[model samples]
Target: MLFRNVISILLIFGTPSLVLGCGFPPDLWCSSPEISEKCGVEKQCSLWHSKQALTDVPLVRYELYYESLCPGCKQLILTQLYPAWLKVQSIVNVTLVPYGNAQENKYGGKWNFTCQHGPAECVGNLVETCILSILPFDKAFPFIHCLETYNPSTDGKYCASLYNLLSYWPSIEECSTGPNGNSLEHDMAVKTNALNPPHQYVPWVVLNGVHNEEIQSQAESDSLALICNAYQGVKPAGCTKTGFIRSPVKKIL
Candidate 1:
């Protein structure tokens, strides 16, 4: 399926509402107490988190359901998602689901997966899943972007090293190669399958827990604008109305 050619299928919430933390999603990058305590001052996360919290502004939800090795998925991640995230991360609750177009079956008392790209892609998915599970969103996302930037099909130790995350690689390796990874991928599968209208392609973008043609097109073309427009509270500097129009994101490939 083409990346920009989105199928407008609406999906229902398949899981219970996860508890929000620090006025946003628990997995939100820098708003939680633990994250704030650890790196808030260093990262200057307070400027964004405190602003949103004080204003009682609800964060715009942005979710991407994609596979590891899909070219279009990589394009969106590298060009659109990552760049837009850096600009609007504070006002957006971003969720990355890596298992896409993959089927699961129980055989020999174990779960087996068939990925869209190949076995390598399944491994890539596990690596990403392990990364997301091991680190908070703030740390996990950069590593993921690095992985996609270089090569998603290989072991992600290089990306981990880039982020001083080698200390956590052993745990990530263990989880990815064992039952932990399987369970995580299964949860992803459940979420992907639960789409009310069922996703028709990878790089499926959902806005505010709902998916449609207009939102998907807007997200793929310029996710920053999409998030900024969807936001209901104070606009971030990038999305300010002081004659600062965000340039349209150019497709990398």
Candidate 2:
């Protein structure tokens, strides 16, 4: 009788329908015959579909912490970062935190920021924060590139219009001018301040959550090489085109 009861309990608990929660090691939690029907059909976990299953390429994590209106930041974004992204975006997971060397204060439930440049920079940072929030990374990047290429302070709406993102402008403007912008910028500030080893200047480049002077110099000088070199396994065509990877010599057997 005890053996029968134990078998019954095992059968009940072992059924895939009884499983709860989905996570990594997707084969087990997502798509194994034991779990696939319930977990895969319901969860539709994008990570497995979009990234992991596609190529199994490990993407390099690159985070740039900078403030609007900083000359070095502008140059890096305009010349190095954006161009490199155009090439290696598929191989790099990029995050831009636009709050560098900024101080924040709260008064009466209202948050105010003091940026490194001035009031214009504060507004510019808020605008960028709103841009990033409103659009997907692919759509937001060009708009940001446009703003930095010309004038972040004045070219916001113009850039949106140029990108046919005019419909989103009203929302972006409202975000920049409202409490949402404050919250977003506050999140950025928190992330920036929490960086290990801390950031000492604008345009601080962090790779895989690590920061150092050598990374800083390399990222500033040749971001493409920096990212390509960091990535492992099945490099994208961009790496070869950019001369970062050489085709291995085949042994003539």
Best by lDDT: 2
Cα-based lDDT for every prediction? 0.75, 0.77
Candidate 2 at residue 186, lDDT? 94
Model 2, 64-172: lDDT tens per residue? 9988888888888877788889998988988999889889999887789998788999888998999999999999989999988887778899999899999999999
Residue 146 displacement (Å), model 1: 0.8
RMSD, one per candidate, in order? 16.4, 12.2
> lDDT tens string, model 1, 1-253?
2111111110121222222222343234343556444432213344444444536878888889998888778878887778888887888889999988999997775679999788999999989988899999999999999988887657488998889999999999899999888899898899999986689888888888899988877776777788888888767787753222333332212
- Looking at model 2, which ten-residue stretch has the lowest summed lDDT? 244-253
TM-scores of the candidates in the order shown? 0.74, 0.74
RMSD of 1: 16.4
